[model samples]
Target: MQGILVSILVGLCTGVGALPFLFIKKVPQALKDGLLGFASGIMVFASSFNLIQPALKDGNLLSVIGGIIIGTMILTFIEHLIPHTHTKNYDENDDSSVLKKNILLAIAVAIHNVPEGFAIGVGYGTGNVSTGLSLALAIGVQNIPEGLVVAAPLIEGGYPRGKALLFSFLTGIGEPIAAAIGFFAARLTDKLLPFILSIAAGAMFYVVSHELIPESHCNNNEMLATYGFIIGLILMIIFRTVIGE
Candidate 1:
């Protein structure tokens, strides 16, 4: 129960990080896309290098592949069903429906948050507070841009200050929900944890390579995108090292 509360606090705190965007002016398209790519890279590295590789050491390759396929398919279908709201940095100018884009992005973040929170819960369940906190902090740190990703476009779309923040905050709720589910269900078992990590890795990798990188490059800002990716990677490395995970 204590662990669950901690997980919830961690998840909620992540959402709160979005509050800063409301006060800032709209970010440039190139910068936004670039940062999105950077966030994508961070997620990719964390999920792949940290989560999936470790999982693969203990889990079956076939199961890991299956999990990735299923996770990818699941995200694909959801994205298809939901309307996509491109970021402010879709190009020099973006004219897509902001509401639709925000909703889709929110759904994606929400869905992604679930597994992340779950990973934290599972860590605690295994009696590893440091591991759980590390995971939560990593995800939380990763989510700051995710919050920006949700709000920046909405601000472009003409959403009011409070509403944009509110929506961004709402999208972030998936983290704790994931934690609760993971803690209660005990899904992150020794046998199953690796597969679950792989699923998240595949889903995140697809998002970064397919969605974020492509979008960032659409603005022809390769340098900016690369910088963001490198920065994100470095930050993750530092966090991993400090956390000892």
Candidate 2:
């Protein structure tokens, strides 16, 4: 119960992060690319350290590998089923293009939040309130930057500030939902947690490679993107160090 409530608060941090955009009118293109790159870097770090590494420790290599493959395949299938355009030739004025882009971004963010919620749920499931709260705090802190990542693109794509913030918050709502699932199903899913985590990592890897990174580089802001990526990784490192794993 406590975990579920904390998960909701963690999810709201995404909206809190986007609050700045409400006052600021415009975001530079280079900055947008950098933000996207930052998002990619954070996702990559989370996938590798927070998900895959822990999975590897908890399960066999073969099973973990299999889970990753399955995860990638699942995301690939979803991508095909969804009708969305890449950022290469984005047209902000084109209503169809804007809608498609926002949809894809929202979906990617929601999927990314699932594993994070699971971690929170499992932490609480261990009967350690401190551990659960710690995980919640770390994730919540990280979520602030992610809010910017989501809102920036939407605003750039011509979404109203209120709509962009709403969308960003909506994407994060998945975390609490997944946390609820994880909390209730923890005992039943214990043996499968490693595979589940690996699957999430794979899904995130696909999102970074196929979605965020490409979009970040689309504007020829590769240098800014690269710098943003480094800073993002560093931020994650600092958070992990300060938060204690």
Candidate 3:
């Protein structure tokens, strides 16, 4: 129960980070690209260092490898089934582009957050306070920048500040639900947990490559995007090295 609460708290950071966009009307293009790149970096590093590594330690290497393949394929299938629209499909100058991007981004983030929330709960359930809180803190740190990534476009695209933030908040709710589920699942079956963790890693890797990175580079600010990705990657690597170890 305590671990579940902590996981929910970590999930709530999504809303807290998004609170800033409530007053802002526009975001700079360079900043937007940077934020996207940063998010991509975080997801990539977190998936590789935190999720996959831990799975390898806990389970057979073959099962973990299979989970990774299956996870990536699952997300890929979802991508095609959804057929979501995005800013690139419409003119950036168009008024509706921002809303479109936000819609798709929110959906993707929400789906991913469930696994992340579960991971946090499982960390605590399977180990101790230190394990749980460390996972929570890492997700919480990433959520701060993610809030910026989700809200910036909506504000510029004519969404009222409140509405944009509301969308972000709603997506964050996935964490608590998954966290509770994870806590229970880990306790019920030891064999399943490792594969689930690896699946999460693969799903996140797909998102970073297919979604966030592409979105960042879509604009002319490729250089800023690259710089942001590198910085974010370094930060997450260091963060994982310290906390996830």
Best by TM-score: 3
Candidate 2's residue-wise lDDT over 108-172, tens digit each? 66776776676677656646565566567656765776677778777866689998899889878
Which pairs, if any, clash in model 2? none
**Local distance difference test, each candidate:** 0.68, 0.75, 0.74
Which ten contiguous residues of candidate 1 have the minimum total lDDT? 85-94
Residue 80 displacement (Å), model 2: 2.4
TM-score (C-alpha) between model 3 and the true structure: 0.86
Output the lDDT of residue 168, model 1: 75
Better structure of 1 and 3 per TM-score: 3
Query: What is the alpha-carbon lDDT for the whole of candidate 2?
Result: 0.75
1-245 in candidate 1: lDDT tens per residue?
Answer: 75577766665654575676656857776776667666766776667755567667778889789878876886787677864534543343435544555677777777667666766665555455675666666666667777776777677677787887787777767666667766654445677776666666566666666666765776668788888888888887887787775
Of 1 and 2, the candidate ahead on lDDT is 2
TM-score, each model? Answer: 0.81, 0.81, 0.86
Give the lDDT of residue 93 in candidate 3. 68
Whose lDDT is greatest here? 2
Rank order (by lDDT, best first): 2, 3, 1
Residue 205, candidate 1: alpha-carbon lDDT: 65
